[model samples]
Target: MLMPIAALLLTYLVTLALAGLAAFVLRRPLWVLLSELCGTEERSSFWTVWSMVMMIALPLLFVSWARVETDPTELLQGTVAATLTGILMAMGGMGLAVWLRVPRADSL
Candidate 1:
């Protein structure tokens, strides 16, 4: 039980790191593209940040759920772990985006 939980925690952490890095690297370009597509002069990091988080979070949750045993306790624990992991990843990603400074849509 402990070993499986540990593995699950490690899996989520590693996934968070990778996903956050990817979001950091791509945020600018994605923002530019989205702004253009929407024809908006305003600059908002909402799309890039949340979209990336959801993109990874949803699939991860599904996969983790499918992989877990039918035991109620195990399912509850896995759900909690995945939720916490996602929250951490999103915060990290948002911090990165802000630290780097997303440019104005028209500036690029």
Candidate 2:
């Protein structure tokens, strides 16, 4: 139990750092897209990177929630219901990440 917990923790932290690095490097496309969406004369690098990180983080959290996470454990346990719910949650998280990445009208 202790070993697995340590390993999971290590894995989560390492992967999160990698994901953040990847998001930072790939920030240009998001900057372009967001700039277009906001109709801004200049790209907002702060918001762009922030959105990218959030987009990556959301799904990662959902994945960690399932096993070691029992709600997701059922899916791992091969239950059909769990599988459907897991897929739905993943999609919802993805959508939310994208939604959150988008600045609201008021923000613009």
Candidate 3:
């Protein structure tokens, strides 16, 4: 019913918020590491893309490591789907943010 939908919506919102917050906090460090790995000091699309990708991947890795104590149910499946969707959405938003942050040649 509506209750189940509401629960799923809540789960999605919570997941999106937490993942986005984590991405926001870790963006700078991630960019630095990526820039070093790529051996580039200047801003480039490559670093921003990889940083956003890692922002999504790292959280997913953590989630994959977590063990669920309860048995699988339809609701649980729905929740899982919602969570994944939210994570992807958050990553998409992060991609947009980073794209904006990166300097363009035309702007320089």
Most TM-score-accurate candidate: 1
Colliding pairs, model 1: none
- Candidate 1 TM-score, C-alpha based: 0.49
Models, CA RMSD each: 10.1, 7.8, 10.3
Residues 1-108 of candidate 3 have per-residue lDDT tens digits of 336446545544545566667667767776675575456766544766666566566545544454432333654565455456646665676567656766789998
Worst 10 residues of 2 by lDDT: 74-83
Clashes in predicted model 1: 0
Q: 22-81 in candidate 1: lDDT tens per residue?
A: 567766777776676545645445566566767467536644665653455765566556
Give the Cα error of residue 103 in candidate 2, in Å.
Answer: 18
lDDT of 2 by residue, 45-108 (tens): 6667556656456545654664542233433343333333444454465457558777689987
Q: What is the C-alpha lDDT of each candidate?
A: 0.60, 0.54, 0.57
TM-score of each: 0.49, 0.46, 0.44
> Backbone clashes per model, in order?
0, 3, 0
Candidate 2 positional error at 87, Å: 14
